[model samples]
Target: MPAGGAAAGLVAGAATFVLMPFERVMPPLADGLPDRALWPSVILVAVLAATVFVAVWRTGEPAQGFVALLCAGAVGCAVIAALGDAAWLLFPDRMPDIVPLNAGPPPVRHALSRMEAQDAYVAAIVWGGLLVAVLAAVIRPVTRRRTAALRTLTFAFAALTSVAAAAGGKSEAVLAALAAIVCGMLTPATAARAGLPDRPASTAAGD
Candidate 1:
C-alpha cells in the first residue's frame, strides 16, 4: 500500500505540474460563460485524479495502472498540440473562440484551429478517456494478474495513439509516451506482488 501511495502521489504531482503551462494557452473567459474551451482539459485532470484513487484502492498496483494513465495523458496532450490541426475541419465548432475561424489569415486560422484542437484533445479525450478506463481497470483488480495491468496500459496507449494519428498531430502522443513510462514502473510492481509470500497474521506479526 505504501508503494501504491507513493506511485499515486508521484503521478498526481507530476500531472499538476505539467498542467501549469496550460494557463498560458487557455482561452479568456467571456461574461462568465464558463470558457468552454478550457473545460475539456480541466475535466481530463479531474478524471485522472479520480482514476488514481480508484486504481490504488482496488488492485494494490497503483504504480502500474494509475501512473501509466498519467503518462499516457501527458503524451496525449503533446500529440494533440503538435498534430491536431491536420484534422481540425472535422470538428469545426467543437471549441469556439480559440479556433480563429473567422478572425485570422488562412494560415493563422489553420494554426489556431490546430492549437485549439490539440488543447481540447489533451484535456478532454486523451486525459479523460484514459482516466475513465483506468477507473475501470481499478474496479477490476488483478491481485496476481500482471498481464491484466499491462493489457490495460497497452490498450490505453494504443487507442490514444490511433486517435492522435487520425487527428493528424492534434493527437495525444505526448500523453501516450508518458503513459508508457508509468506502465514500465507499474509492470515490475505487478510481477513482484504476484510472487509475494502470503503469511498468516500471527506468523507475520511474530517475525
Candidate 2:
C-alpha cells in the first residue's frame, strides 16, 4: 500500500506540473479545462477503486468494498457535475461569452474576465481539495504513523465540501462529502482485513 501510494502521488504530482502552464494560460472553468484536467484524477480514482475491490474480495469483504467503490464513483461524478454547474451559474451573464471547450486556445488578449477568473479560482480550490481528500482516503491504510492525521484531513475535506456546496448550491458537494465520509470509514475496515495497521480498531478487533 505504501508503494501504491507513493506511485500514485508521483503520478499525480507529475501530472500537476505538466498541467500547470496550461492551467495558467486557460481559465480552469473555461472551455473543457475542468473536464480535461480532471481526467487523470478520475483515472486514479478508478484504479484505486479497482484495487480496493480486489483487495476486499480477496479478504471476503467484497460486498462492502464494492458498494463503497460504486458510491465513491457516483459521488465523484456528482461533484464534477455540480462544479461545472456552479461555474456556469457563477456568472450567468458571462455564460454566453465563455469560450467553448473546442474553440482552440482563447486569444491571449482575451483572458478570463474578473468574475470568470474568480470562479476559476474557486473551482480549482474545490476540485483540488476533493482530489486530495480522495487520495488521502485511498492511501490512508498504508500511511503508517500518519493514519490519524490523514483521517482528520479527510473529514476536514468533507467539511470543506459541505461549505462549498452551501455557498455554490451544488448538490454534488453533498454527495462528495458523503463519499469522503464513507471512504474514511471503509479505509480502516479494508486495512484491517489486509493486515495493515490503519488504526486502533484493527488491533483491538483482533482481525
Candidate 3:
C-alpha cells in the first residue's frame, strides 16, 4: 500500500506560484455566465491538479516523476505554441480563441504582432503547465486496469479539445494536442526511468 493525500499542499502551492499567468489565457465568463462561476472552475482545477499530482507520484519516481512531468508538459506547451505560431503565419484567419464559439462565422483573425506573440509565448507556458496538471493526471501507468481507465479519460479530454479546436478552425491547436497526448502517455514512465538507479538484474517497475 502507498501513502497518499499529502501532496495536495505541494501541488496547490506549486500551481499558485508557478501558474500565476494562467488566468490571462483562460476564457472569460462574463459573456454568458456570472462571475461567481469562476470559483467552481477554480475549485475543480485544484482537485484535478491534486489528482494529477497523486497519479504521477504513483506512476513514476516520486519527486522526480512529478518534476519530469512538469518539465515535459512545459516543453509540450512550447512546441504547441510554436506550432500555433506557424499556423498563424499560414492561416491568418484561423488562430484559436479559448472562448466558446458563436453561432456565426467569426471575423478575421490577424497574424500575431510582435508584442502579441510575446504575450502568447507566456500564455503558452502557463496553459501547458495547467493543462498537464489537470488533464494528464488521468494517466496511471504500469497497472493495466488503472492505465486503461485513465487512458480513456485522457483520450476523452484529447477528443474534446480536438473537436473544440477543429470547430474553432484552429488547426495548429489540433496538431499541438498530439503533443499533449504523448505527454499523458509517456511522461510518467520516462521520468520514472530517469529517476531510477540502473541495475543489471531487474527492471524498475511502476504501478
Candidate 4:
C-alpha cells in the first residue's frame, strides 16, 4: 500500500515542481532522505500486511485468499528492495535529511553509475514482475506493470539509503546492486496450487 503510495508520491511529488515552480510550491523527496526504517518502508510493510489481512477476511475462498495475500506480500517485498535499496545504490551522493515527502525540491540524480543501474532496475521490474503476472493466479491481482514499477523503485529508495548508511555511498552501491539482484529473485513469484491439476510430470527445476 505505502509502496504504491510512495512511488506515486515520488513521481507525483517530483511532478508538482514541474506544474508549479518549486519556489511557488512545496518540495519533493530526494533519494532516501527520511530513512524509512526504508523510511516509510517500515510503514509500507504494515500496509502490505494489511492488504493480506484484508484478503484473509474478505475473500470468498480461504485458499484463494491466502494465495493472493502471499502474492501481495511478494509484490510488496520486491517494491521495498526496488525502491529503498535501489535509491542508495544509484544516487550515492544524495543523503538529504528526513523531511516531509514534499518538504524539499525534487532530487536530481548525480551518480556516475546511475544509467546502468537504472536500466538494470527497470529491466528487472518490467520483465520480472510481468513474468510473475503471466504465471500467478490471485483473487485480486495488481496491474502487471504496477507491481513491476513498485519492484523497480527499491533501487531509487536504496540509493538514498546507501548515502545515509555509508556516509559516502560508494561501495554501498556494490552491496546494493548485489542485494537488488538477489531480491530480484523474489520479484513477486507465482505459486500453483499444491497439486498439479493433472499430476502430469515433466521437466521442472526441482524435479
Candidate 5:
C-alpha cells in the first residue's frame, strides 16, 4: 500500500509541477474572475495532499516517499518557471513577439521569438517526462484488483484534466470542472491490502 500510494503521489506531484508554469501564464477567461484560472492547479495540489494524508493514516506509517516526491516536484516546477521567467526578464523587449494568437493576414498563426521558442521547447520536454511518469504509475500494480482499477481510472482522469488545463487553452470554468471531477473520483479505498489482517489458509481434513 505504501508503494502504491507513493507511486500515485509521485505521478500527481509531477503533473502538478509540470503544469504550474502554464497555469501561471494562462489568463483569466474573463474579467473579474481571476481566481478561476488557478482553480485547476489548486485542486490538483489539494488532491495530492489528501492522498498523502490518507496513505499515512491508513497504513499507520509515515509516507516518506510521498513527501520526497512532492519535494522533487516543487523544486522541478520552481526551476522550470524560473527559467521561463528569466528568459522573459532578459529579453523583455522581445516578449511581445510571442503572442498567444495571431490576428494577422493569411496564415494566421502564433509567433514566438527564439528565446521564447527555446523556453517552450524546454517546457514540452518537461511535460513529456511527466507524461511518461504518469503512464508508468497508472500501469503499475498499486492495490487489489478492484481498488487498483479505481485508482488507475482516477489517475487517468487527473492526467487528462491536467493536460487540458495546461495545453487546451480552454475556459477557466471548464478546467475547474474537470479538476473537480478528478477529485470526486479519487476517493482512496479504506481497506488496502497492506492494512488488512493476514489470514491463514485452511488445512486438509485427511490428516
Candidate 6:
C-alpha cells in the first residue's frame, strides 16, 4: 500500500476510536419505530458519509477512486440500516425485527433523526445513494486495487460486529465506540484518496 493510504487509514482509525463513546450524547432518530434502542451505528455512518462526500468534492488531487470507495460504503451501510423501515411498512405484522442482530435494548439513539424527521426513509436512501453513486462513477477509475475496498469492508464489518456484540452484552457504549471507530477508519481514507497527488515518472534524460 502507498504511504498516503496507510497514513489515511491510521488517522481515520484513531479518530473513530476517540469519537465512539459520545453516542449517548446524540438525539433519538425515530419516535414511532420499534427497536429504537441506541445510536452508535447511525452517527458513525452519517459522519463517514459527510466526510467522504466533502473530501471528493473539495480535493483537486487524483484520489477519486479511494474517495468513491469510502463514499459508496457509507451509503450502502445507511441503506442496510434503514431497510427495516421499508419492511415494516410492507408487512406490518411480519416486520422483520429491527433489533440489532446481537439482541440488545430497544434503541434510544436515532442516527437519522434529523433526516428522518423531514423525509421518509425511502427518500433518504434514494437521494443519498443516487448522489453518492453518481459522483463515484463520474470520477476517474480507482487503480489502487483492493486495498481501499477491502479496508472499507473491514471497518464496516468490525463496526457492525461491535454493535451486535454490544447488543448481546446489552452495552450501548460499546456500540457507539465501534461506530466512531468505523467512521474514523472511513473518513481519512476517503479524504486522502480524494486528495492524493500523482507524481510523474522521471525520464532517463530528465525531460
Task: Using lDDT, give the best candidate's number.
Answer: 1
Q: By summed lDDT, which 10 consecutive residues of candidate 5 come out lowest? A: 198-207
Candidate 2 lDDT, 38-109, residue by residue in tens: 776566656665655554665576544543443344334334434444544665454434445554455421
* Per-prediction TM-score to the true structure, in the order listed: 0.31, 0.33, 0.31, 0.31, 0.30, 0.27
Model 2 ranges with Cα > 4 A deviation? 1-53, 67-145, 168-207
lDDT of each: 0.48, 0.47, 0.44, 0.38, 0.42, 0.38
lDDT of 5 at 158: 47
List model 3 lDDT by residue over 1-207, tens digit each. 011222332343333323333223534332344554465457536654665566576665454345444544544455535543554567655344543345234442222232243355444534553454453453333333344444555456455555555465344454445445444544344322333444332343333
Better of 3 and 4 by lDDT: 3
Q: Which parts of model 3 are misplaced by more than 4 Å?
A: 1-31, 56-65, 68-109, 112-118, 121-123, 126-207
Give the Cα-based TM-score of candidate 1 against the true structure.
0.31
Task: Return the lDDT, model 1, position 189.
Answer: 53
lDDT of 4 at 136: 33
Please provide, for model 6 over 21-137, each residue's C-alpha lDDT reduced to its tens digit, 9 standing for 90 to 100: 212232333332354423434544554555555555655443653554444443443443344244444544532233344443434222233223323333333333333333333
> Candidate 1, which segments miss by more than 4 Å at Cα?
1-42, 91-207
The lDDT of model 1 is 0.48
Better of 2 and 6 by lDDT: 2
Alpha carbon lDDT of residue 52, candidate 4?
49
For residues 13-90, write the lDDT of model 1, one tens digit per residue: 434334443323543332134554365456556656666666666767656455545444533443444333433556
199: Cα error in model 1, Å: 23
Model 3 root-mean-square deviation: 12.3
Q: Please report the TM-score between candidate 6 and the true structure.
A: 0.27
lDDT of 4 by residue, 49-142 (tens): 5554554565445554444443443343345335633566665565333334454354523232343244333332333233233223332333
Tens-place lDDT per residue, model 5, 53-136, is 765676575643353333334333334444555555576554444444454542232233433444543443344334323433
Report how far residue 27 has shifted in candidate 3, in Å.
Answer: 8.1
